[model samples]
Target chain A: MRAVVVDDASPVPSFEQVRSQVAAMIRSGELSPGEHLPPVRQLAADLGLAKNTVAKAYAALESEGLVVGDRRRGTLVLAASASPETDRVRRVEMAERAAVRYLAEVGHLGFPAVDAIDVVRRVASAD
Target chain B: MLGDWLSIVVLGGLSSLIFVSGLGPFTDRMLDRWCLRYDVAVDQHGREWLRTQLRRARAWRWCGFAVGTVVSALPMYANVIDRNRAADFATPANRFAPWLLAAAGSVVGELLSRRPPGGRRAAHLATRHWRDYCSSRWVAVVGWSVPVSVAFAVQATQSRDLGWRWSWLGPAVALCGSAAVTVGLRHLVNRPGAPDGLDRLVDDALRADSAHHLVGASVALAGLGTSHAALALDLGWLGLLVGMGQWLAIAAWWYVARQETWNVARVRWSRS
Candidate 1:
């Protein structure tokens, strides 16, 4: 029954909350590999979130290999990878993509370079 | 002159009595029965979270009652300030205040009733709709202003005579708003882009449509009550029937509205 709430008040959607929380939990080893996540419908109802929100989050988790989906068995967290090198590489890639998206969004939003950096720094620090 | 004012008091008293005695219990029973029967917000899976929200909702009911009492009484205070105190007691302002209080109370009651107990999942669901206060439910952004603005505009006018013009105006506006809600809810439910599981979700919601229909019935009854009050204004034998009908409708509407609000409140959400 334990679940986390990303800022519900934030402009961020509930699915994003599910995605980030599940990811954070996996990284922290709180939800060990092989732990059965609650069924999407039940979890969504439990969280007052839309059912699709949880489904989307689960889809993301599955794609990252942090969780495994078996049609018959349902979804389960996979054991954490043994390779630190692979983990480091994945983290760097994620960070790079996030930076590119942030910069592009800032430029499009019409913020000056210095202001955009400040905004990024603030968001990063808050997170 | 005093006799005329007394008659108005008697009329208002009778109407209030019906609402308090008959409609109050009726609404409570309907709420219980509807909750037991279809359970529009049932989380076949989130049993524990559902229970927690119910508890919060129960607490909110008490809060609704308290807040409703205050809001309803405020109009009575205004009536007291008027030079025609006794006559104004039966004015539309005083009579309408209680119903508004009750509706406002329902919201507070609903929120209080659904507070989360603990645990990550429960907490997650409890806060799930927080963004709704900001974005998704933009209608809610104007929620408080609409009614208050309407009430103030109507009450601030100098006319003290009770007539169909103002009474009908209030309900007409309400009906229009409800119609908008029904249409919007229908559209949201119909969206094809909804997640694969949305069909089941909407199906579950639709299964309780009968309950929603009952709310419609309640509204119709309340309309009847207003019609009766309008009839009674003439101070004829017909007024008796009109007054009686108005109170009956008030009670019915109150019951139906209670059920609908409860149904809406039971929906537990997750991160989505």
Candidate 2:
């Protein structure tokens, strides 16, 4: 029962926000194989976003092989694929969300994108 | 003829009672009874918010009840005024139409209460299922028995008591009603629930508690339809006995609801 938040003020598009959060949930095994993703219309209404935005996010997930959609059974997470491509997609999405959150928080402090990335590089090497 | 007319008058008077009850005193009692069970009252604001919400819901439900009463009463009224067409008007088709309409109208009214509050901040990620709100095994038994009751009515039709036998309306309403209730309840259970920012557990609890009324409405409506079926079949004492099964459904619901309320209260107060 993990949740997704749509931060209205974030620079990321709503669709990406939805896609990334749901993607993260699947990758972390929060939403399992055969588990239903919330109905697109319901998720859209709750997030106060357009239904198309949610639908587009779902489309992105289906394209990534993270979920499958059926008109009758609704959108569901698919079993994890061992394909390297699927793994890369999940990795990139997880990093993108972390980056977005970091950038959003740092952007408020008047830091440039270059400075934020530099901080990330410095912190990674230090670790 | 005199006894028949007297019976019509008595029936008409019951319709009026149904009307006055629709004005909302009874509905309010129903609302309070079911809601108070899950009134978590995390604070003064949450409590007051729920109160205002319920008041608004009560207003909408009253309108629905009024609409149902008027609809059901129209046929009964026509039956009286056009006494010459009494046989046609008093047929089981028209007789049970009111109950069916009234049940549907009430379900519509329940839907109206589902407007999400303005500026909700977060939503539950969990997709609610019927099992989440109502999973008692006993409830399953009562729900399954509704079909048996309907089936009994069908079996009763084999008798050549043409004057007192059942019509298709009773079974039709029960079947169609089961479908309608299924769709209606599924929507209610899964619909965007309590305002997003409320404590998730509290929000879930409030929604679950509200759903109990819907569960009750469903069972009560099925019971009414089944009761009507038994009565329509004109099984004499046997029909009356079967018809009383509705009360059993209601009683089972009531006992379960009360038990749930006490269980939650005891757990919450004791632990927290």
Candidate 3:
């Protein structure tokens, strides 16, 4: 399995780092549907994270229908979106990557990502 | 006298050979066999990396053996042969010399085996992983602390019985030593950065390394307890039991460390 790198020094919290990375992996088809992710405890230990942090990330992924957690089995990946297609996956991957880059850019410019999103929403409403 | 020196030479030489040359290849062969049995495909680069590590380890072990032999021989000559003060050839210092030599040798070996460029990034990632592990498992930190506390209590009680006006001295020292060792192991193993290749295997390797450190610490404590029981409490049987426990712990540690290291290699290859 491809390892997720979490940067503690970044403004992003560990759980967000985990969540986004897992999401990206799913969208990129690196983690396929029905593939089991590592156990929460194991991943937490591997990443030197609190088990809760990883659990929270997994929970977020589950809520988004990106993965499912079973008591007997482990956490398994689900389709990234409503339908699985090469183009759809590509679009989702690109969108996610763009969002990350935009957020990072805005942050570097000393603006909140939410403010930028609000500005985009206002423009869309006017249009 | 001649026989004693000869025996030391033979034993030291054999130990050096086994530690420096024999174990690495033996471990590698076992890893290969296990991987084959499990249908794990090891990448060429991963295999090369593992081999390189083994080579470095062997060199360290040899260096340690050589240093230990020379240092130990000095005491044997001066205390036993030259002075004829005692028939006992194995003084405490002499017995400890090899381990000291080995420790120094390993450090030197590590220094010599510098990672290539981009190693820093790998190391940073590994450290971050380790920090996450430690932070998440706060309970484990507490678990380790319990042993050190217990050790302190044991030492303190013994010291008081031995009529030390400063009973806390022994306990304080013991506590500091245990804490230092625990912290040192955590830092040492985690500092190297994450192993490249299979994430699963890297996790297993880290787990195994942690287990090895915990077991090693337990063994050390058991030895300390045994010594205390025998020397302080005059409980020979109890000391014997503790000594046996220590050996058992050591045996378990060896098995886990060996198996996990190989498993780590397997994962690295399988992923590669």
Candidate 4:
């Protein structure tokens, strides 16, 4: 997977940005199962984040069971453990989260709630 | 003497041609290997830039060869061929004329070869960055300075024992000259503006070039400084410690340069 980008100006914390990006890559199958992520220090330098931030993101991924950190080797993506129902529920949660973020962004752009919903509906139906 | 001059001219000209022709392809292959190892995908513009550098290198090599040959030949003729006229050329100034000529020729050759396609501002920024790289760390300065300083100190104290009032002059001149050349050469080699086609790749390549120059300058300065110190102190044992320090400095410089180049390439690639 490509290096994760963290925007300092964003409301999301840097660690969360790293965590969410890695998680999204995992769900999208871009980061393969058993694939090794870059070392924490390497990733931190690449992303311009503190070592603690990258380490925290990796720890969060471990807790979520998406990846495992081996002492000798590096961090490895774990084979996903979700059942089909759980996977569907996870997808729903991700979609709702994305929708909320989209709404928040559009709201700041002077988009009314009805117009935002209409825009989403139009984009979804067109897709 | 005439036979020696003939042999030198013939041999030097042939060697110079062979060296330049061989070095161009060798350097190109080396760059290709480096790119493969570092995962740097060179675009069309990068290739063009590499071609330009190779061409310039060949040109500079030939210029150096020609200038060196002329310089050596003049001294040889003065000292050997023209026995009666040797008195005039035997002065210290005349003896050192070849080196001065070669140095001047190299500078001119470098300037002629380093005419970048970019604008002045880009070239200025590039030169500034290259200078920054050369003198970035106090440790590097100290690394070159300590040995030379020690040599000067030793010379000052031992000048009476050695029966020379100006024993430190040569070492001082050598130290200052090498330092100046190192900084100047580094600035000359770095091309500032982005290449026309592959902006990112060219940028990475230029950075890698900067790193390579830094490593070269550091290693050369280390050798020069240590040798001058050994000469002044006349202490063979001190060589061991100095050599170790030089090696450590070289390793550190190489590591730093490699890290910088890798970071640049990685960041550029990631963005793309």
Q: Score the docking of each candidate (DockQ).
A: 0.13, 0.21, 0.04, 0.01
Task: Identify the leading candidate in terms of DockQ.
Answer: 2
Best by lDDT: 2
Off by over 4 Å in 1: A1-127, B1-90, B111-221, B224-239, B251-272
lDDT of 4 by residue, B137-162 (tens): 53355345656656664764665355
Chain B vs. true chain B: TM-score per candidate = 0.42, 0.68, 0.56, 0.56
For model 2, how does the per-residue alpha-carbon lDDT over B1-272 read when each residue is reduced to its tens digit?
55656655775666566555555343445545645665544454555555555554444444444454454445455556786665554455444455455546545655654445554345545555555554445345436646765675666667544443354445565564466456656666555555655555555565455455455545655665666666666566786686677567557546543445423432432222
- Which tens-of-lDDT digit does each residue in A29-106 have in candidate 1? 877766777666556655666778888998988777677655566667765663677556546655776777888888
Worst 10 residues of 3 chain B by lDDT: B119-128
Of the native A-B interface contacts, what share survives in model 3? Answer: 0.00
Ranking of candidates on lDDT, top first: 2, 4, 3, 1
TM-score, second chain, candidate 3: 0.56
**Between the candidate structures 1 and 4, which one is better when assessed by lDDT?**
4
- Model 1, C-alpha of A59: deviation from truth (Å): 10
What TM-score does candidate 1 get on C-alpha atoms? 0.35
Model 3 per-residue lDDT at B227:
33
The models' CA-based lDDT, in order, is: 0.47, 0.61, 0.53, 0.54
Lowest lDDT 10-residue stretch of candidate 2 chain B: B262-271
Docking class of 4: incorrect
lDDT of 2 by residue, A66-104 (tens): 887777888878766536765676567567767888999
- Tell me the tens digit of each residue's lDDT in model 1 across B1-272: 45545544664565455444432322434444544654444343343343333344333333433443444444344454564563444444444444444433333333232323333333221222222211223234223323543453355233445555554444443444344334433332222111222223333333233223323332432344345334423446865775575566556544543443424434533223
* Backbone atom clashes (below 3 Å) for every candidate: 28, 0, 7, 0
Which ranges of candidate 4 are over 4 A from the true structure?
A1-127, B1-15, B18-31, B69-74, B84-143, B146-150, B153-157, B160-178, B185-191, B214-218, B236-272
